[model samples]
Target: MDITVYRPGELTAADRAAWAHVQSQAVAMGSPQLGNPFLSPGFTFAVAHHHRGVRVAVVREEGEPVAFFPFQRSAAGVGRAIGLGLSDCQGLVHRPGFQWDARELLRACGLAVWEFDHLVEGQKPFEEGATGTYASPVMDVEHGYEAYLGHLRSHSPKFVRTTLAKERKLGRDVGEVRYVHDERDVGALRTLMGWKSAQYRRTGRSDRFARPWIVDLVEHLFHTREESFSGLLSVLYAGDRPIAAHFGMRTPAVLACWFPAYDPQFSKYSPGLVLHLRMAEGAAADGVAHLDLGRGHKEYKESLKTRDLTVSEGWVTRPHPVALGHRARRAPVRALRNAVTAHPVLREPADRFLKRVGRLRAGAR
Candidate 1:
């Protein structure tokens, strides 16, 4: 086997085709997450446009590409899965039974340590590197949106009725409801970022939209359209006003829920839920088989998820002084965060503290 590293844009037509072939083979591995849109080359291409640090490792067997690994290298030689925080599925998209040493792979990329928070489970090379695993919720909608609604009606009947009724009520009270599964309005995108940023600060979490690179990346992707991967902007509008929206990525078979927000003033109308229900309807109609809500827990995720996938979080480090130094710098904070997230009792208190801090920050501002 041979390995070569290059920027995402450096890939030739053959390289892209080989990458897609390998990714398609991944679906036979038999899990929805393995087929996530984030793992596709189109995503890497968009990120490469905004981030020079992005790199891809093409692993070949007998001169044929068998796998692809995309990551970002920081100045200190520490690496992270490309679009770590923003990407829900992370792994070396490869053919089944492919063998490679994680350490060797890192060395070839000149990375001392490779960190991943949403590593797809069953990735053998990094199996021993995981510090923990978490559930990633998903909704299998291959059977169509109505079938899913039937499941919801049998389970969370109230949730389905309330959301549907809210959609009707919102339409009647405000104006005719309009939904665009692929909205191209730039203003709607900015509104989503603003709402997401304010929500992050109000909840005492770091606002990702505050980072210019992330903003640029999203903007770049929003304009990108491809068969394997494309940016999807779903918006719910009342008359001429946007009320709820979601910006995510979708492959022909899967859609990833990334940033979703709604007008707080319409919170009583449950526009967020209405938007998601519409999203599912749109996805099913488009032949999208699954919707990945991503790794982590939330009431909405629990209420809507039909299944779960295991995603790992940890770092794979090659034995070196730089690796040790990086580990020492990050381990404590990572461990504390993992502990809090793993324990609901602790997480609740931590959440409350963060919200209080957020309130103080808002007051100061």
Candidate 2:
């Protein structure tokens, strides 16, 4: 295999075409991460606009590209899956049957250690290094919106009744309720960001939009329109007033749920839940087979999801002094977090601590 590396923006049209070809082939497989829209070449392009560290490794055989590995390399020779903390799924886009060792590939990319948290299952090369597997909730909507509701109704009847009743009440109390599955309004997008930022601060989580690069990346993606991957902004309105909105990415077949927020004034009506229900309907209408809710546990996800997809959290490293040192530094932190998440008894206190910290932060602000 001949390996060539380039910054995303540096890729020639031919390189992009090759990358897209490999990306398309991978989507043919049933795995969610392999088909994740975030892994598309277009994502790399958008990310590169703000993050200069964005890089792609194109593996070619006889001058024909067969695989595309996107990643971020740090100054210390450590590497991370492209959009590591942000992307719900991560992996190399490769043609079926293409074979290579993960360590050799890491060496080719000049990375001492490569870290990933949402690696797709059955990634043979990285499986041995996986510390744990996580279940990412997904709402399989291939059977259409009503079918999805049927699943929800069967599994969580009260949840469905409550949300739908709230939806009806919202329509009755507010002006005519409206749904925009693929909203093009920039103003609504900005509103979503503001709401999301406020939500993060209130919840004691770092606000991603506070970072200029993330803001730029989202804007770049919003303007990027492609069949394989494109930013999708969905909004719910009540008589010309936006109540809830979401900004995510989607392939022709899969929807990757990203940022979602609602006007806190309408919190009582659960407009965010309404937005997702409509999103599933809209996605199904667009022929998307699944809506990947990403990796995490939330009451809403549990109530709405039809099934779960397994992903891995861990690092892959080649033997090197720097790699060993890096591992030594990260192991304990990773161990602690894993332990906390695995046990509910510990998780409750951890959550409470975070909430208290959030309260302090809000008070300070």
Predicted model with the maximum lDDT: 1
lDDT of 1: 0.89
Worst 10 residues of 1 by lDDT: 26-35
lDDT of 1 by residue, 1-365 (tens): 58999987789988998887778777766644567888999888888888769999999888989889999998889998888778898989888778789999999999999999899877878867888889999887899999988888988999898888988999999999999999999889999999889999999999999999899989988988877788999999998799999999998778999999988888989898899988999999999998999988788998888888889988899988888998798789989988898799999999999999999999998
Per residue, candidate 2 scores C-alpha lDDT tens digits across 1-365 of 68888878778988887777776676676444567787888887787777767789999898888888999998888998888788898877888878778898889888999889999866889877888898899999998999999999998899999999999999999988999998898888999999999988877788999998899889888888976789999999997899999999988778999999999999999999999999999999998989999888787888889999998988899998878998899889989988897788998888888878888998996
For candidate 2, the lDDT comes to 0.87
- C-alpha RMSD (angstroms) for model 2: 1.5
* Pairs that clash in candidate 2: none
What lDDT does the true structure give each of the candidates? 0.89, 0.87
Per-residue lDDT for 30 in model 1? 66
TM-score of each: 0.95, 0.96
Q: Highest TM-score: give the candidate number.
A: 2
